[model samples]
Target: MIKGIKGVKDILPEETPRWRLIEETARRWAVLYGFHEIRVPIFEVTALFARSIGASTDIVEKEMYTFQDRDGTSITLRPEGTAGTVRAYIEHNRAADPLPQKYFYTGPMFRHERPQAGRLRQFHQFGVESFGVADPRADVEVIALLWRMLSDLKLPSMTLEINNLGYAADREAYRPQLVAFLKQREETLCGNCRRRIDANPLRVLDCKVPQCRAATEAAPRLADCLSEQARAHFGSVLGELEAIGIPYSLNHRLVRGLDYYCLTTFEVTSTSLGAQNAVGAGGRYDALVETLGGPVTPAVGFAVGVERMAMMLPLAASSSESASVYVAGFGDRGSAAGFSALEELRLAGIRAVTDFRSGSLKSHLRQADRLRSQFALIIGDDEVVKGSAILRDMETKVQQEVFLTSLSSQVSSLLRIS
Candidate 1:
């Protein structure tokens, strides 16, 4: 038998409730925070990522899934969400329309990486981006949205770590000192770290390799190189987070993988996720808009790994079947009437399911039990002849006969769908 690809997962029927729960939670909070939904193409010109994510980063250099098209154009499946959102913001001339536009998107992202728990070649992310906002308050707002999604999900042992990557100029000043430190310990660093030292020195500090991490432990902190303005911006973000009572700690080592990020950066890590503890992360990027050929627009955003979040979900969230009703239609005329009732219930805003193929009332009830339906709308010949259907509480096995015409309204009332 043929099997699924490595590092790629199929979210099966049994597993979708958890995903819906996570996605729905994100959508509800995004709406509460004034973030509109935006959908972008899954793939874009490969240069878009390389230029925005940085050529030196692992995502651009080693992990991107780039393929040549028929016309020989290099296209890549998006490895992250922010770049595409910014591309749309510029290409659609949104810069001229408004200031501080916010958007949220949930979908798949591709990267070439080894398959492992909480990591995948084709994983999903629920991300939000806020554009054209330079205020530190915008940073705080985006961080609040991020915290809301994870906090409401009730994941345990989650910690919010914030940092100041400072501005690019600040990093430039800190670079020589950081590069000097890494160079002194060059022998202990990984190959990736050595290459990153010259190209993106800050990344060497961000490296997860044991040797690279230990080697840079005593390196000069970027916080020291932060400009006065950068310091104020980060200070405001921290003070506001405190004002809002969102728990957080300062972690100078919390650098994002992308190169566009600057100033305030943050991550939410859960002990439940093991070594790959980061469930979501993002930061402010003040220079990316101009870098991508648009007017300089400062933005802040975050991306949550949907798979990792799903893994952290409690078992109670695994099933979403309770809110629906099953229509068990047996026999010819009863089945026909049942089909009509199914549509009526659905049109009235009820979630209804059916198995007309069930040959007997016993079989139909069996199927409804298997579905874990809260209520079963049973229509057999006798009930059809009476112009009524049986509403059986699958859990209680208590049955009631209601006229077919009132089935939708009755079910709607019973399910409290109004």
Candidate 2:
């Protein structure tokens, strides 16, 4: 037998309801915020990611699955949504249509990496992006939408960690200072952090490796480097979040894992997710549209891992019990009567099923028990002759006879199903 690929998972029938609930909840919350849905291709020219996500970020350097297409153009399975969404925004000239166009998308994202509890090689995300909005209110809008989404899921022990990355020039001035500090413990830092110093020095603060984290504990905080305008922009975001009663914590080191993010960056983390606790994260990207070869546009967005959201939501509450009816038909004439009743029950707004097995009454009842149906419409040779069928409540083991002529209405009233 052929085996499925490693690091990817099949969302089997028993698991779909949990996924559907997460997806529907995200969609409902996004729509409430006036965000429409936009979908981009699964693959795009590799340079789009390289330019937008950052050449030094892990997603671009190691995670992305890139290959040469038949025409020799480099292509990659998108590792994140914002870059692709921005590409579409610029390609379609959405800037010409509206001031701040809001869109939300839910789909799979591919990254070749080690698979763990909630992390997968091919994982899914629900993302929201707001374009052409440079105000601090725009920052609060996306952040509030993210907080409301996870809160709506009833997830446990989640905290909102917010950080200010300031503007590009703020980083440009602070790089030498940060690099000088990093080089002091050069040998003690992780290989990735050491390499990032010359390329993307800010990433050293976000490193999760124990030694890298330790070496950078006393490193300069980016918040101090924030420009006067950037500081006020971040302050307004906090004031709004507080006014709305959404509590948040200020984290000085939470430089998100992307190149385009600037100004406000925040993440919602749940302790229940163990060491890798981020449920979702995003920030303002004011320069991305211009970077991707389009008119300058300001944008902010967030992406939530569907798998982690599933892990936080209780599986039992994710799915509701099915109210089903089984048609247990015995004998040739009984089978014919049962077939008719099956269709009638469904048309009457009942969940119905059949095994198409013909046998004694006892065997048919066993089938009904296996299916765990709420009601079983049993038809035997005698019931068929009488133009009636027995409605057995699988739970109470109670049976009643109803006419086949008005089977649907009679069952509808008898079971109170309709």
Candidate 1, which segments miss by more than 4 Å at Cα? 209-211, 322-354, 374-418
Error of 2 at 76 (Å): 1.5
* Model 1, span 1-418: residue lDDT tens: 9998889899987789888989999999999999999999999999999999998788998999999999999999999998999999999999888645999998999999988889999999999999988999999998999898788988888999999999889988998998888889999999977887888787777788998878878899999888999999999999999999899999888888888999999999999897789999999998999999999888999999999998988656676665478898888888898889889988988888877678788887888888778888988888889999888888777787788978887787777732
> Candidate 2's residue-wise lDDT over 1-418, tens digit each?
9988888899987778889999999999999998999999999999999999988778998999999999999999999998889889888889899545999998999999998878899999999999988999998999999999888888999999999999999988888899999988999988878888888888789888998888888998777887999999999999999999898999888988888999999999998897778899999999999999999888899999999998877767755455577888889899888888888888889778887754777877788788677888989889989999889898888889998898888887876752
Query: Residue 206 in candidate 2 has what lDDT?
Result: 83
Instruction: Mark the regions of model 2 whose C-alpha exceeds 4 Å error after superposition.
Output: 321-323
Candidate 1: clashing pairs of residues: none
